[model samples]
Target: MVAERKTHPYLSLMNSYLIDSPQPSSISYWYNLGSLLGLCLVIQICSGLFLAMHYCSDITLAFDSVEHIMRDVNYGWLIRYLHATGASFFFVCIYLHIGKAIYYGSYRKPRTLVWVIGVIILIATMATGFLGYCLVYGQMSHWGATVITNLFSAIPWVGNDIVQFIWGGFSVSNPTIHRFFAFHFVLPFILAALVVLHFLALHTHGSSNPLGITGNIDRIAFHPYFSFKDLITVFFLVLIICLFVFFSPNTLGHPNNYIPGNPMVTPASIVPEWYFLPFYAILRSIPNKLGGVVGMFSALLILLFLPLLDRSLYRGLAFKPLSKFFFWLFVFNFILLGNIGHLHVEVPFINLGIYCTIAYFSYFLIIVPTISTLENILFYLGRSNK
Candidate 1:
C-alpha cells in the first residue's frame, strides 16, 4: 500500500507546483508588477530608517537638521535623495499595480474587498507621502501644506475648525510639523497592516491572472513558480533603486525644496509632488473652492466604484475591443490631465482639462456600460453561428 501511494495524484500535483511547476509557458515582465510593488515597499522602509536616524522631530531644528545631515553627516545627501526619489518610484509602482488590477478585472466580485483595501492603502500612502513632503520644511513644503489643508475650509459647517485643528494654528507651523511627523510614522504601520490584509484577501480570492481565466484546477501552486518569479522581479527592482540611490538621487525632487522653509517667500507656482498631478488638475479645473475640493477628491473616489461600474461580461480588456479602447483612452486622458496640471492655467490648458475630465468620467461611468451592452449584443449574435 505504501509503495502504491508513492504516486498519489493530489500530493503529486501539489509537489509539482511547490517543489517545481512547469516553467511558465509565455509570460511578460508586466505580470511581475505585484511583486515589484512589494519590493518598492521594502525599499521605502529601509531608506526611511536610515534617514530617520538624522531626522530631528523638534520644530526648531527640523530644517537645520536636514541641512546638518547634508553638510555634515556622512552620505546624508544620499540618504535624503534616496528617500525622496523612492517616494516617487513607490507611487509609480503603485499606479502600475492598480492598473494591472483594473485591466484584468481583479476588482470584480470575490476580490472586491481586496481592491477596496488597496484603495484605502493608496489613500493612506497619499497622506503619508504628503506628510513626508511637508516634513522637508521648505517653501514648497509650507505652500503645499497650506493649499492642501485649506481645502478643508470648503466644508459646510466645521471647515475652519477642522483646518485649524489639523494645522494646530491658523497656518502650518511647529505643531503641524510635529503632528505630521507623528502621523507619518504611525500611518505606514497602518499601511503595513492594510497590505497584510490585502494579501490575505488576495489569497482568499487568488490573483486575477493575465488570461483572466476562472477556476483553479488548471491553476499552478503559488509557492515555487510564483515564488521564483517574485524573487527575480524583486532583484531587478532593487538594482533599479540602487542605481537611482547612487547616481540620480535628487532627480525627482524640486530645486526649490533645497532651500529652507521661509514663511515670507512662496515659489512662483506651488505644485504638489508629481504623483499628485492628476488630482491637482481636477482641483484646479473647477473655479469654485468647494466645488474644486469635491472634484479633486471625487477623482480618486471614482476609482473605488470601478468594480460596480465595469459591468462588462468579459473580464480582460484585451478581448473586448470597445473596452480596450476606453481603457487606453482613459489612461491617455489621465496622463494628459497630469501634464496639464503642471502647466500654468491657460485657456487651452483649462479647456483641455475640461474635455479630458469629461472623457475620464465617461470612460468609467458611461462608456463602460454602453460598450458592455454592445459586447453582450455581439456575443449574442456571434453565438447564433454555433
Candidate 2:
C-alpha cells in the first residue's frame, strides 16, 4: 500500500493553490503582472508599516515627521521612497493587468465576479492613495484635500454634514489628518482581503488565456513553468522599481508636495497625482460643481458595466477587427485626457477636455456594443453563406 501522506495543513494548502494549480500554457508575459502587482502590494504594505511607526498624524507634526523620516531615521529615506514610488508602480501594474483582462475578454460569463472584484480593488486603491497623499500635509495636499472634500458640499441636503463628517471638523484640520491617516493605514488591510477574494473568484473560473480558449489539454501546473516565468518578470520589475527608488525618486511626485501646508495660501496650480489625472480631467471638464463630481465618479463606475456592455460573441480583440481599432483609440484618448488634465484650464484645454470626455464615454456606451453587434451579424452571415 502507498504510504499515507503526512504533510502539514498549510503545506497542503500551498501545494493545491500554488504548486498544483493549473493555468493556460499559452499565457504570455502579460499574465505575469498579476504576480508583480501582488509583489508591489507586499512592498507597499511592509514599507507603510515601518513608516507608520514613526509617523505623526497631527497637522502640526505630519510634515515635519515626514522630513524627520527622510533626514534622521536610518534607511527611512529608502523606506519612504519605496512606499511613495511603489504607489505609482502599483497602479502601473493594475492598469496593465486590467488591460490584459480586457484584451482577453476575461470579464465574460463565469468570470464576471472576478472582474467586479478587481474593479472594487481598484476603487479601494484609489481611495487609499488619495488619503495617503493627504497625510503629507503639503500645500497641494492641504488644498487638494480641501477641494475634494468641498465637492461633497454639492450634495442636496446632507452635503455639508457629510463634509464635516469626513473632515471631522469644519475644514481640513488636525482631525482631518488623523482620520485620513487612520483610514489610510486600515484601508490596505481591507484591500488585501479584497485581493484574496478576487483570486478566489479568478481561480473558480481558471485564468483566461491570450487566445481566450479554455481547454484542459492546453493547461499546465502553475509551478515550475508559470512560476519561473513570473519570477523572471518580477526580477525585471524590481530592477525598474529600484532604479526609480534610488535614482529618480521624485520624478513621479510633485515639487509642491515638499513644501509644508498653509491653509492661508494656495498653490498657483493645484493638481492631483498622475494616476488620478484622467478622472480629474473629467471632473474639471464640466462647468457645474456637482456635475463635474458626478462625471468624475461615473467615469470610474462605467467600468463595472463592461461585462454587460460588451455584447460580443468573440472573446479576444484579435478576433474583432473593428473593436481592436477602437480599443486603441480609446487608449489614446485616455492619454490625451491625462495630458489635458495637467494643462491649465484655458480655453483650448477645457474644450479638448470636453471632447476627450465624450470620446471616453462613447467608447463604452456606444463604440464597444455597436462593434460587437456588427461582428456578430457578419459572423452569422458568413456561416449562412457557407
Candidate 3:
C-alpha cells in the first residue's frame, strides 16, 4: 500500500493535504469558510468564462451584448445571475473569514505572511469586481467607471496622466471598455495564484483555532470529518444562490444598470456595488480630493499592519474582555460606514460618515494596541498577585 501510494505523486500530495492532514478537533463551522471561498472562486471563474464567450467589449455593443445574453442565449440569464450573485457571496465569505481571523488573532507571528497575502487577495478581488462592473456599460456602470477612474486625478502632478492611462484615452471610451474587460478577465487568475500562496503560508503554520492554542496534540484527519462538513455548507450556499437566481435575481443589483450607458446623462446616485460601500464611504468622508483618495487606500493597506499593531501577549480575543468588546464595536462601525455610503452625501450623513471613518481607523490604530497593552499588564499583575 505504501509503495502504491508513493507511485502516484499527485495522489500522495492529495492524501497529505486532504485525506491524512490533521486539523484541530475543536475547530468549528467558521473554518468551513475557507473551503466555501475556494468554491466561490471556481463558480465565478467558470460562470465568467461562459459569459465572456458571448460578451462584447466594444462600448457600442457592450450593453446590447448583455441584453442578448439575457434574451437570446438559452440559460444565459442564469449564468449572468450566478456570476453576479456569486460575487456577492464571495465577498460575504471573505469578510467573514477576515472577521474570524481578527477575532482569533490569526495574524500573529508565524501566520503574518498568510494574513498579508490575504489582504492582497482582497485588494485584487475588489479591483477585478470593479472592472467586471464596468463591463456591462450601463448607466451605473459607465458613470461608476468614470467616477472611480477620476479619483486617480487626485494624485500630485501626474494625476491626470494616470487617469488618462486608466481610461486608455481621454475618457471612458471603446479603449476603456476593452481594457477593463481584458483586465477583468485576467485578474481572477492572479487571484487564484494569490489564494494558492495564502494556502501555502497557512498550512506552514496550520490553522489558528478559536482558543488560540496549538492543535498538534489534539488533531484529527481532514477526510470524512471536515470534508463532509464543508460539503454541507456548499449545499446550503447553492440553495441560497438558487433562490436568488430563480426568485429575485435583481434584488442585489442596481436598477440603473438595466438602462444602456449614456455619457450624456448621469444617474441620480452614482454608487458602486454593495460590497464596496464601506470603502466608498471612507472616500467620500474626506472633503479634499487628494485626502479622500489617500484615506480610501489607507483603509485597505492598514490591514497589513495588524500583526504589528496587535501587541497582545497572547493570541485571540477569547480571554481578553476589552479587546473582544472593541472588536464587536469595530464590526458595527464598519456596517454603519456601509450604510452611510448608501445614503446621499448630505449634512447629517456627511457628518455620520466622517465619524464612522474616524472610528474605523481608530479601531485599528488606537483601540487595538491600547486595549492589548492594558490587557497584558492586567494579566501579568493578576498572575503576580496570585
The TM-score that candidate 3 achieves is 0.98
Runs with alpha carbons beyond 4 Å of true place in candidate 2: 1-8
Question: In candidate 1, which residue pairs clash?
Answer: 16-20
Q: What is the C-alpha lDDT profile of model 1 across 156-180, one tens digit per residue?
A: 9999999999999988889999999
Order the candidates by lDDT, highest first. 3, 2, 1
Instruction: At residue 85, give the lDDT of candidate 3.
Output: 95
Q: Between prediction 1 and prediction 3, which has the larger TM-score?
A: 3
How good is model 1 by TM-score? 0.91
The model with the greatest TM-score is: 3
Please report, as a residue range, the 10-residue window in candidate 1 with the lowest summed lDDT: 17-26
Top candidate (lDDT): 3
Backbone clash numbers for all candidates listed: 1, 0, 0
Clashes of 3: 0
Q: Rate the local accuracy (lDDT) of all candidates.
A: 0.80, 0.91, 0.93
Clashing pairs in 3: none
Task: At residue 193, give the lDDT of candidate 2.
Answer: 99
